[model samples]
Target chain A: GAGVSQSPRYKVAKRGQDVALRCDPISGHVSLFWYQQALGQGPEFLTYFQNEAQLDKSGLPSDRFFAERPEGSVSTLKIQRTQQEDSAVYLCASSLGASAGGNIQYFGAGTRLSVL
Target chain B: AQTVTQSQPEMSVQEAETVTLSCTYDTSESDYYLFWYKQPPSRQMILVIRQEAYKQQNATENRFSVNFQKAAKSFSLKISDSQLGDAAMYFCAYWGGANSKLTFGKGITLSVRP
Candidate 1:
């Protein structure tokens, strides 16, 4: 892909329903990250992956929120029993590596999840 | 704990004019990174510029540049000759090596008047 790609640009889920959002990072990108952006707010980090290794999950808001990158190239963020407060944009970003210039992250268009 | 703050919620600038957005951060780490990212209505975050903590010189890319005050923990973005295409939500972010996650401020909506 020319840039990071996310599936289901928009999602509408009923409360208590589980939702899965997908992210496909750029080819050869060694770092991937997931973030949550509330309405009219900047993004907050949720989790990070260095290849298939989940280096950091400290940012995940709750136990209901989970993310995995089994192959290092693609990732999924799943939220169990969605609540109204879960409504927000889910963003994914990827970088070439964790080195000097790799700090620059390329973001996807993001998935706007609306829990009703 | 590290935090980034963007006190201003919105800013407007005349086309072809220049505009500077304000940002302040708090951190104890000596080695860190600062970034400015732009998110248009399309919702894709694009990196405008970045500055390393160790660098004494400001970072600039074309019309976009940053005024980094390491001592005050301030990093602001200046867009010269602003264009209507520049209209978007601009965010200030901080990254510490130990944290490994980007901390972002409440973004500022920038409108370029044509």
Candidate 2:
């Protein structure tokens, strides 16, 4: 893709329902990241991946939030038993991994998840 | 721990005028990266400009530039000749090191008036 792409630009999920958000990064992008942006707030880091390896998961809010990039080309963020507080925009970004020239991260039009 | 702060929740600027958005961050790391990103109503976050901690010179991009004060831990974005299209949410972010995750501030909503 020309830029980072996220699926289901808007999601309305009922509490306790499972929701899966997808991200398609730029071709051959070595690094991918997931962020959650609450209403009236900036995006907060959730997890990062270098290739298929999950280098950091420390920022994941809870056990209910999980992300994976199994093949490194695409990624998925799954939320199990969603809560009302989970309502926010889920953003995905990609960059050249492990290179000094890859500092700029390109973001996608995030998926707005509204849990009711 | 690194923390970025944007005190202004909202700002307005007349078209073709200049405006600056304030940002302050605290970081123990000697070398890191600071960035400004713009998010329009479409919700796509785009990088506006960036500054490296080691760089004594401020970073600039066309109409967008940054007044980076390493000692003061202040990084403010100045948009010259602001345009109506410039209306959006501006975010100040910090990265500890290369390939590090970003820490962002609360963000400021910029309204450009024609």
Candidate 3:
């Protein structure tokens, strides 16, 4: 793909329902990142991945938030028991590995999740 | 922990005019990277420009240029001959080398009046 792609551009989930957002990064990008953005705030880092390894999950707000990059090419962010506060835009970004300096990150359009 | 700050919540500039957006950061690290990203109505994050803290010379991309002052830990973006399309939410971000997360400011909403 020419750029990072995210599925379900818009989603509405009832409170307590689970939602899964997917990301397809540019082919061969070794590093992947997930961020959460509220209505008027900047994107906040949630997790990071290097290949198939989930190196950083420190930013996840609570135990309900989970992310995985199984094959290192595609990733998924699953939210369990979604709450009204969970409504936000989920962004996915990819970058070259450390050897490339990881200076630039390409981002997806993001999935807008609405929890009622 | 590093933090980026953008004081202006909203700014307005007329088309063809020049406008400057201010940003300040606090970090103990000597070396790092600064970036400016634009998010329009479509909500896709786009890289506008980047500056390496180790370099004295500022970065310029077409009409976008930055005035980076390492001593003050300030990185400001100057848009020359602004266009209507330039209207968007602009963010200032920071990253410290590899394995580091990018910290972003709250963002400034830029409005270009024709």
Off by over 4 Å in 2: A99-102
- Clashing residue pairs for model 1: none
Clashing pairs in 2: none
lDDT of 1 at B70: 94
What is every candidate's C-alpha DockQ against the true complex, given to 2 decimals? 0.66, 0.65, 0.63
Task: Write the residue-wise lDDT of candidate 3 on A9-115 in tens digits.
Answer: 99999999999999999998889999999998999999998888998999999999999999989999999999999999999999976323334899999999999
Residue-level lDDT tens digits of model 1 in A1-116? 89999999999999999999999999999999999999999999999999999999998989999999998889999999999999999999999986333368899999999999
lDDT for each residue of candidate 2 in B1-114, tens digit (9 for 90 to 100): 889999999999999999999999998888888999999999999999999999999999999999998999999999999999999999999887543588999999999998
lDDT string for model 1 (B8-68, tens) is: 9999999999999999999988889999999999999999999999999999999999999
- Candidate 3: which docking quality band? medium
**DockQ for candidate 3, C-alpha atoms:** 0.63
Tens-digit lDDT track for model 2 on A38-81? 99999998999989999888889999999999998899999999
Q: What is the TM-score of chain B in candidate 1?
A: 0.99
Winner of 1 and 3 under DockQ? 1
